[model samples]
Target: MDAAQHISIYSSGNRQPDYSPLQSTLDRLKKRTEENKVTINHTNTVVMHFCTSSQAVAHPQLSVGAHSLQLVQSTRLLGVTVDDRLSWKQHVINIVRTASYKLYMLRRLKSLGTPAKELRDVYTAFTLPTLMYASPAWSSSLTLTQQQQVERTQKRACRIILGPAYDGYDNALTILSLPRLSERHREALGKFGRGLLCHPCHQHFLPPDAPPPRCATRHINKLVPIRAPKTDRYKNSAIPSIVHMINSV
Candidate 1:
């Protein structure tokens, strides 16, 4: 298949490379724990995770810079501890799992005749944000108890986000966070989501520091327009005005 051509992947072709940066971090953490690395014993890691993954998913092209920046800022509020991040082995594991999710989603979409780009867009919009977590902040390096809590929290979170994987970037989070959305936009969103596959609001707005979208249109939208604002990628010759039958709306 050519690079530009649509690759018919039926949940089997999506393969993300394994990039675990946690194992080495664990080794470092263990050494530090044994040697009393920095005298700081415990702090909240959920805060770091929440900030990092939240920013990453929010950005187009998955900005590691944004994720790391958020991670650093979070460390400031909670506590600065970059001692044991980027563990190699753990990153590899994450790669496999992330790949699995991608593959499954790809196959499902291909079967539905959904374009690869759309599949990528929808999944990136919905799944990535939900996967960003703030629980299970510790692992074997910390203690059995902390590891257990992290595990439980991770599992519970995955459960909450698994089935509704199709609903990319739940605007519901905004509803819960903003009172303005509550009064004016909440009800409209539910109606807006009625078979409304694309997310116009997301296309229009997102947190700053994201990458630029090549084109932001109904048919094809790549990135979320990071570098510039007020950019709209619309088709010049799209035919419209086709009336359709109402299907239980």
Candidate 2:
């Protein structure tokens, strides 16, 4: 099975970063691949440097053997687009565009006298998956505008399905027995949190459980909240956001 590998290099506190260690690691990897008679695809290999600082900083020039890897601002991994800044804006736009296109098929079906129930099923099977794919990873980080942008696609789908009787987005959801996109995102996060608790491999990703109170209290069951994040990006990241949700319940 082919897979992409990610290597993270951290610098000592407040010190100028070093690339020598990363370069050495790459050399060893190249050696191992050579021993196995596997050729590395230089063109597909690229570097993405992640940092929160707004100021421009010099990037390291990294090479594997004779091939110098290109630097990219963003790349797709496992169908999710991740930018160096981790803002998730580009990812949202891409999914929204794709979902909107899928709505065209729904329109074509409607014009053919398809039943409303079947059209709803088509939307669920074809378009909704595009919007909800990997939602837990990026949903909490979405700006209000981005969230609205995604919701519009569903609203359009509602109009296409209900035709003249469509009232509004919320009312249509109630009539169709469908949850709002934002509500679905929250549900996805909660389900993912439960899965983390049940799976041994993912348990390590969860924050530590709250210490037992000296005297029992109603809140004793909550997991410990993470330390206050230094940036909004970190605060709204999947792990921290999910911890907040779990504790609130």
Candidate 3:
């Protein structure tokens, strides 16, 4: 990490509204995540399975919830040190790249194009139990080619975010950054991966932002949906404040 570029440019880039230094860092799709089960020998007796809500592996819980947690936690430690920042930033970039590939792959799958509603419903149903990773999200029925792609992305996410050395598992960037008060906010996950706010929380971890469902503005938006909206009087314990932070971002 170049001190000049990393400290000033990197930190400042984070403050900018549309700045994305990560865009360049995230090149081709990363490698696949490892299987939940690690075979000690050729024998099938010692089998291990990555448990989730459903038998289907592509549903959407662990993929979304877990990933989000890792991202923010790493960001929280940014600019502090070299060894601390490297793996976190690398993992963050890797997860983002893998997640984008997943959305693209899902969208590209002709079978998934039956109807947007059905697709969404199927996703929700297959994903509900696994909502917090109680099931498998993919199927063995996919063509060899597609299976390879899913494996690639999943492996990438798993390796970097859920891998053996993922910075003590304290990611969750955007989610924890939400207000703690609102109870209606749902986890704002990408199509296939998680964000910081993995589960429901009544207040923003940062403190100043209103809860999720409530607007930081004057009124509470029931129609807006999602648990935990920010409150009108919400204030940030951090230096500038969430309002200021949001604007800066």
Candidate 1 global TM-score = 0.19
Worst 10 residues of 2 by lDDT: 6-15
- Give one digit per residue, the lDDT tens place, for model 1 in 64-109: 2113212332222221122223222343244335534655654566
lDDT winner between 1 and 2, please give it. 2
User: How many clashes does each candidate structure show, in the order listed?
Assistant: 21, 0, 68
lDDT for position 187 in model 3: 24
1-249: candidate 3 lDDT, tens digit per residue = 422212111312121223233222221111111143322121211111212223333211111111321222223223221122222233323433545444443344334444434433433333222222310111211234533443344333322322243332123212122121111111211211121122255234423333344336764322112234353212211212323333332
Question: Please, what are the lDDT tens digits per residue for candidate 2 over residues 129-202?
Answer: 99999999999999999999999999999999999989988899988888999999999998997678656677
Model 2, which residues run further than 4 Å from truth? 1-15, 209-220
lDDT (Cα atoms) of all candidates against the true structure:
0.30, 0.84, 0.27
In terms of lDDT, which candidate is strongest? 2
TM-scores for all candidates?
0.19, 0.89, 0.21
Q: Tally clashes: model 3.
A: 68
> Candidate 1: lDDT over CA atoms?
0.30
Task: Give the range where candidate 1 is weakest over 10 consecutive residues by summed lDDT.
Answer: 236-245
lDDT of 1 at 243: 6
